[model samples]
Target: MKPILLDVPLQLETDRLFLRAPLQAGDGDVVYEAIRDSINELKQWLSLFQTIPTVEETEIILRNAHIDFLKRESFRYLIFHKDTNEFIGTASLHAINWKVSKCEIGYWINTQFSGKGYMTEAVRELINLGFQQLRFRRIGIRCESTNLSSRSIAEKLGFKLEGTLRNDDLSADGSKLTDICIYSIIM
Candidate 1:
């Protein structure tokens, strides 16, 4: 089946959070704020946040993300608090291979929300969406081996450590080589 014909939900919910595609025009403001507040921590793992982005740049990124979501090229959901409607972070099912029925999950949380298990819960929902709703045969999470927080999410959710690739990629800042840990769960 063509991925474009698939009916993906615009929003998904958990007890404390809601995940939605970046569809609204002003969505970037909140996302930008989160990025600004989390930049110090985010820069360690995510290259995109190596420098703080202006609100306009962030808005453009989100707008493009909306287009990607519609095209089924990738699904980037902005995570938010359920009751307060506060933006918390983002979780994405990306690097999709439709014929292989697989994709990778990528995520980050605002520093203020870290260590609270919000990211774990949000990722758990994405896993369910991939296997059950998207019918993906395999979903993987690949992160820097030093990123214990990310590795923990995959482990806590029962993803197996498929392998670790030594010196697999450059660090987010391109300063040094880093090992990559690959984790996966099959439906």
Candidate 2:
């Protein structure tokens, strides 16, 4: 089946959050603000946040993400609070391989929204979407070994620790080598 022809949901909901594709022109403003507020923490794990981006740049990046969504190359869901409608963070099913029926899950939360289990809740929804809705055979989560919080989410969600890659990649800031932890759930 063609990935572009797949009937993927643009939005998903949890008890406290909603995850949606970045489709609106002005959506970047909120996302940019979240990034700005969480830049320090984000920079530790995400190379994209190494430098704060302007609103215009964020908008452009989101536009490209929309294009990717349309092509079904990837899905980037912007997380929001259900009642307050505040942007929490983003969770993505990327590095997809439709033929193999597998993909990787990636996520980050605004510093303000961290430690509330919001990210873990958002990811649980993604896992359901990937397995039950999308019918993926395997879903994987990869994070730097030093990112204990991220590792905890995977562990808490019952994703088995497959292995750890020694000196797998450079840190987000490219300052030094870092180990990569691989976790997965197989359907």
Candidate 3:
């Protein structure tokens, strides 16, 4: 099996977005605001939902992610609107299984910025990075079945639906089992 983590800096840009490596410790404020502003929207999908971070806590979060990036176990990116360079969302490829040439992608965009095709563009660009640059055979995205918009993005990106995991998520207020619709693209 080949090692997935490389010393090379990974960066991808679409016509409308700047998709680069995750932020460093100095970028805590920006990350905090991005998460805080979109907390309400993110809570709907993520299992480990939390209240908005304060400036201090945000610094800690950035430091941790930065360290993870250095370790090469997970890769997280901050989505930036190209025209305005505005922070839009966060995306990550986690649990990378280099031996199998696979990884799980996770993302969340601000509610206010939803439905403008920003995420779709980001995902497509990221998929290319995974398949072409990283030598990945398949990339998977799992989202709550109720998240219609996310599912639509997966479909738009040419991922084949691989069925659902019944009641696989427990978070927020209830223990409702979320049907995780797995979508994959084999390169």
What does candidate 2's lDDT look like per residue over 1-187, in tens digits? 7778989999999999999999988998999999999999999999999999999999999999999999988899999999999999999999999999999999999999899999999999999999998899999999999999999999999999999999999999999999999999999
Count of steric clashes across candidates, in order: 0, 0, 1
Cα RMSD of predicted structure 1: 0.6
Q: What is the lDDT of residue 6 in candidate 1?
A: 96
Q: Which stretches of candidate 1 lie over 4 Å from their true place?
A: none
Candidate 3 has which clashing residue pairs, if any? 167-177
lDDT tens string, model 3, 68-95?
A: 7777777788888988878888777777
TM-score of each: 0.99, 0.98, 0.90
lDDT by residue (67-93, candidate 1, tens digit) is: 999999999999999989889999999
In model 2, where do residues sit more than 4 Å from their true spots?
none
lDDT of 2: 0.95
Candidate 3: deviation at residue 43, Å?
0.8
Ten-residue segment with the worst summed lDDT in candidate 1? 108-117
